[model samples]
Target: MYLTPSMAKLVHEFNKLPGIGPKTAQRLAFHILKISATEARVLASAIIEVKDRITNCPICYNITEDSPCSICKDTTRDHGLICVVEQPSDIIAMEKTRVYKGDYHVLQGAISPLDGIRPDNLRINELLMRIQQEKVKEIIIATDSDVEGEATALYLERLLRTMVARVSRIAHGIPIGSNIEYTDEVTLSKALESRRIL
Candidate 1:
């Protein structure tokens, strides 16, 4: 099917989004065309609003509309404990659990040499500066369980171990309701390694 120039432009812009393929982008573009001008304005305004207002927290680098994010401003939480993650989105996942009452640091991305992302490309210096300036007692590595996540965690560990704080990685293993028999080798290995005395 041949798209008009306008439709093609819309599809092209949508295709630039992560996880959006040509077909999906085309579908989304068609959906946009179906919506009312008011709805389109609302959607477009939302995107623009986020880009204009959201900024990284000065202390932790989490996305925020305020100067520092609420988590960073909350002095009741443990300022000395920091949970490190790849992105600000990860902080949302951690917050949903309500188990951690500590501060956070967003690395913004993981270490992926293939993508040309290195330690210097991340907010690592900021993290180290936070450790030195604050009386931090622990640094938790909560990156994803991928190869890049592992590399980033290892790199952070080596640097953090020399600090006065305890450095630890979040355990990776089988999820709830999953069968051990069907588990992959890496998952099984991690599960076994993370086991504690009953």
Candidate 2:
């Protein structure tokens, strides 16, 4: 299929994004072509605006328009507890729960030796600095359940034990509504391990 030069270029750009296959990129490019010029310009402008305005928070490494980010500046949140996560998106997921009212430290990426991501590649040093400077009493490792995330969490837990008063990993279990019979062995094991007395 010979797409117009402009459409081909747009598809190529879209394909550069993670998880966007060539077919999906072509579809997106065609969809963009169908949209009005003004609407397309608005979309383009929004992308440019995010690139121009967003910067990592100085304290937590979360993406924000401001230096410290709103969470770091908030006086009502718990300053003595810091939840560690692999990315800024993780912070968003945690915040959506509305239960945790603590500070965060975005590691920016998890430890994955196979992918060449190491402790130095992330914001681990910055997190350590924050722990030393701030009155952080508890450090919660909230990395994902994958191999890299688990490795990152374990590494952080060990490193933070002597530094912080308490270091704990977030409990991994079967999701709330999921059926026990359908749950995988690892998830079942984790759920059992994290079972509460209540």
> TM-score of each candidate?
0.94, 0.96
Measured with C-alpha atoms, the lDDT of residue 126 in candidate 2 is 97
Candidate 1, pairs of clashing residues: none
Candidate 1 residue-wise lDDT, 1-198, digit = tens: 899999999999999999999999999999999999999999999999999999999989999999888999997999989999999889999999999999999999999999999999999999999998999999999998889999999999998899945998998899889899999998999899989998
- RMSD, one per candidate, in order: 1.4, 1.1
If candidate 2 were superposed on the true structure by all CA atoms, what would the RMSD be? Answer: 1.1
Tens-place lDDT digits, model 2, residues 25-107:
99999899899999999999999999999999999999999878999999999999999998898998999999999999999
What is the C-alpha local distance difference test score of candidate 2?
0.93
> Candidate 2: lDDT of 170?
88
Off by more than 4 A, model 1 = none
Quantify all predictions' global Cα lDDT against the true fold: 0.94, 0.93
Report the poorest 10 consecutive residues by lDDT, candidate 1: 164-173
